[model samples]
Target: MKQLLVPALLALLAGCATTPPTPLAPTGPKIDTTYTAKGQSSRARFLVLHYTVSDNPSSIKILTEQQVSAHYLVTNGPQPVIYRLVDENRAAYHAGVSSWKNYTQLNSSSIGIEIVNPGWTSTPEGGRLFYPFPQEQMDVLLPLLKDIVQRHGIAPENVLGHSDIAPLRKQDPGPLFPWQRLAQEGLVLWPDANRVANVRPIFEATLPDLFWFQRKLATHGFAIQQTGMLDQQTRTVLSAFQMKYRPSDFAGNPDAETAALLEVLTTPANAPLPVVPTPVTTAPVPPLPPATPPVPVVPETAPAPAAPLPVPTPVPPAPMPAPVAVPTPATPPVPAPAVVPATPAAVNTP
Candidate 1:
């Protein structure tokens, strides 16, 4: 019994000796990392879409080796792959001299996605032909877009094309890009067709002046100057809008339909439709009635006194202009300055 007890005591001591000592409490300054402020939001407020205008290999090399970069890239063809070229936490040199709404220098606050596309080619007839994004590429892109948009809490209006943010200098992700598809996915805002129809007739009677178009475009988030004329910059911006929403005829003419579309988009109460609007089926503006032929003035007889020779048929008074609708409560239409000509209806497109 003594021998067995001695062996057991020795085994117990050995086990205790093998056990590690408890660690000493850390003595550095304590940082309470658990408490986080709820007032903060993501640095990325906008998602700008672009077209690389080059093949995949060229695109990859240029994006990586050059000063310009994008957060993500979607390649073209049947089996497209998505590449993350730039870290989302850092700014990419995609947007240069860009502005949207009140925000300028958008690269600092936007995530850019460069899609592999040729942008547009000029036809022999002096017309531009834009390339269409493939279905396979779109399928891959849709998921990535959804993921980023969800993670960043991006708004529908904030998903914009390259041309949209920099209308004056860029037209990438051109008319062929299926923005209507994005709208159907609830990733982008589309003007409500019904609202456009409701407002169209009013503009059809007499389209709003160029100054009005500038104000409405600014309200809809384009950084447009109110030049009060149909300038090249305004046309380019207007064309960008047309490419997204109305690709049928984007001649950049300030037509009644364009006016209606602008009004609908800028309306605070506008609820964009999730479905794609039928292409090339915008409600046609009714043709204006021909002006009443002016009555031919009979040559006055020399010194006709008492009997005014047979009174010529009296001309009817001109019809009063239709009342313009003020959809924007924030910006009531300013009375045109006297410097602005009384007759600006005859717009000269540049």
Candidate 2:
């Protein structure tokens, strides 16, 4: 009995030893080298904004290296300079576990730009701990964003933040991010205030049936399913939407304002077209004539007939009489030609 007990214990120990270990969670930065070879050409679109919730560039740079690195980093200072940390072509280790419309894993298709600022929340005690973005930083960001958006052929709506794509987890470029200015520059999408006001009542009445709102958000490239009920996922998606469209107040509730804003955003007429500024000519240039130049008029002239050439007379040949057939002796019948058997041609050997 003692020996059997020992063997049983040993068997239990062996079983425990052979059990599989738990898999490690995905940690640290996601360094994707798939696009490194091609650079910007490898990237398909531009995801144009972010905020490094760090006080300074050095801290942000260190954090980015230790955690994740964006394609570009703009410093927060009086005279901000844009730093190209990673090539635009490579997939920067930003945008973790994200989806937008048909696209999933946006890092594969986007170039992320991080703005250095200490993005923080105010305490109930009313302490001003949150560091605001410097004007100079935004000034630098706008032109850079424009260049990237134009070069990559990224649509105005596609220029979204890390929070917009991964709303459940992130909110880097928060409400303070200059979305209005970017919209004015035609870099991002902005809801028309008047259009949103008009659509407010419709969204409010249909708030109970969230499916309608979810469908519209999905149509506008947000990754949301029309589940009818306002679930946790729906709330998260709505929070993301609020962060982008209604940043001033982002409580994640399906309020009239949020719905109205969404309605305006989804409408084509409300969407701003890409402004093409006419090139300003410094030197005074002469204006060109009309597209269809005027035809020169010609005076009418009377037509005159010239003298006709003399017609030649027809020549007549002398008429000849038909000869009569001479009668001749009957010739003997010709004999049939003898038939000969043709010889077969000899075959030639190669």
Among all candidates shown, the one with the greatest lDDT: 1
Clashes found in each candidate (C-alpha, N, C closer than 3 A): 0, 2
Model 2 steric clash pairs: 39-89, 40-89
Give the per-residue lDDT digits (tens) of candidate 2, residues 1-350: 99999999999999999999989988999888766454445355757477877657575657466768888888877888777877876778788898887889888889888888878867889833445677878888888888887788888888888777877788778777777888888878788776766667665555636887789779877777778887987898887788677776676788888867776777798365323345687987789876997788887787787799899999999899999999999999999999999999999999
Candidate 1 local lDDT, residue 97 = 92
Q: State, as a TM-score between 0 and 1, how close model 2 is to the true structure.
A: 0.60
| Model 1 lDDT on a 0 to 1 scale | 0.90
Candidate 1 per-residue C-alpha lDDT over 49-129 given as tens digits, one digit per residue, 9 for 90 to 100 = 999999999999999999999999899887999999889999999999999888999999999999999988899999888
What lDDT score goes with residue 185 in model 1? 98
**Each model's Cα RMSD:** 33.4, 24.8
Compared with the true structure, all predictions reach lDDT values of 0.90, 0.77
Instruction: Return the lDDT, model 1, position 67.
Output: 98
* Model 1 alpha-carbon drift over 4 Å, by segment: 1-32, 270-350
